[model samples]
Target: MLAHRLACTDPPVNLLSRVQALMVDFFWDRMHWVPQSVLFLPKEEGGHGLVHLAGRGAAFRLRFVQRFLTGPADLVWRPVARALLEHCGGLGLAESLFLMDLKGLRLNNLSSFYGGLFNVWGLHRKERPECCGSLFWLLREPVVRVSRFVCGVGPSLQQRLCEERILTLGQVVEVCVGPVWTTLQAWPHV
Candidate 1:
């Protein structure tokens, strides 16, 4: 039930912390020696298997992101989620999410739902840096024009690329090179 609520809402941090402390206290039932985090580990790992509310909340947020990305095309929440993402920087949902740096966004100005979702997503990406090398993932990275690699490239170029439907490095390469670039040998990492 609490998981369901977390999926739909972002509870206040103080409230979550308070509830966590209460749960830990009840579990301990007296003076405790182990750190609270150890309690969240599996019993086989030499600690009680207790739920960590904040980690659970973050898991719920990641689940929401997974659904948002791969859910049925007709999902009722898709449009609302897309609109929320679009509001962040007026960019398309994919661009705002994958191309632009998540830290650069004004996350505080958005609803907690998206703010938390993006935060978790960013952390996930950072934790698994290998994901950045996958062909599908690399394709979503920004081109040199929009990326920090180039100097003095203004928004006009980005706008032009958007107008030309070339928002990513993959698109730019496809346009400049040829469709033959899709061969597996072309990208060793892939």
Candidate 2:
């Protein structure tokens, strides 16, 4: 209910922070010491992850733009959105909204709106790239960076891995568990 209201009106950053802070405080009071980074992790990674509310709200706003673009002609908002898009020309709904700078158009803050738009479009960008039957390609599919998979693994480790010609997660797994495992384990940071 609160989110729905927030979605309509451009809620302030302080309000969003307050809500997140309250959630954190509640968990802290219960003796749950989960890290913020861990909270953002996927469930498969063993964290009780929550979808970002701002992202969801941005998606909701974009849904309106989508409806305007693809929805039945009978709908009232569709015509308005279509007219706006036609008037703007070339620019996408998200871009048009930013360019117009309409005072009445309430997007739940700029960062959330942009983040949501990226989240929606980024998925499509990832899916379109064809993996050409390569094991390394498949391993690199989910994440473009190794640091995202393993928390606290810094740029130095990444550079070392690259220097050793170790690229994908599959390679990392093979090296860590294969005959080279002992040698890798004997390395300074391992």
Candidate 3:
């Protein structure tokens, strides 16, 4: 029941810890002789197969992200998800997920739920070395991701850059300063 609930919603950390303690206490006669980590290991590995709630929660969120990204475009939750993404990154969900400088994300009004989702997605992406360094990923990476002063670049600048279709580092290098200046006439420099 708890596992199923975790798939849909994240429980508070303290609550999860309490639940884990209770489970551990129930498993042991009186005292915990083994480390919690060992208990979380597989039974085949000489430890009881304990379900790590945090890891399970992350897996569930990652699964949801997978479905959101690859599922049919008409999914019911897409609009809500897209709105949240746009609010944070000023772009579509897919575009923001792939192109936004997530490291420098501002969570002023955003919920931590989505923040955790992004962290899980980032970790998942990093796990796949081929995807992290792939041509497609590189081409989709926002210029700010590689910027030295990433936090210094405000959302307005990032949005302006996106509006001008200067999304990636490759695009920034290829674009002519004249065109950018043409659109941003008030700006002294391109």
Clash pairs (backbone) in predicted model 3: none
C-alpha lDDT of candidate 1 relative to the true structure: 0.70
Per-residue lDDT of candidate 1, residues 1-190 (tens digit) = 9878877788998999999889898888867978877889899998789888888989998788788777788989788778777777544545336445655445665787878887777675343364465666566666533343364667677668767767566676678776635655687975
Measured on C-alpha atoms, candidate 3 has an lDDT of: 0.67
**Each prediction's RMSD to truth:** 5.3, 18.5, 7.8
True-vs-predicted CA distance for residue 183, candidate 2, Å: 72
Off by over 4 Å in 1: 33-38, 43-47, 71-74, 126-140, 144-166, 170-190
Candidate 3 stretches greater than 4 Å from native: 44-46, 70-80, 91-93, 98-100, 122-139, 147-165, 168-190
- Of candidate 2, the 10-residue stretch with the lowest lDDT total is 89-98
Error of 2 at 128 (Å): 12
> TM-score for all predictions?
0.65, 0.39, 0.62
lDDT of 1 at 165: 63
What would the per-residue lDDT of candidate 3 be over residues 52-79, giving only the tens digit for each residue?
7888999988888877767887899877
Model 2, 1-190: lDDT tens digits are 8768655655676877777777666656756687776766679998666556656666677675566445676897555444444333222232223223233334333444343443454343222244366443344332213223464656677557646756555556667776445555677873
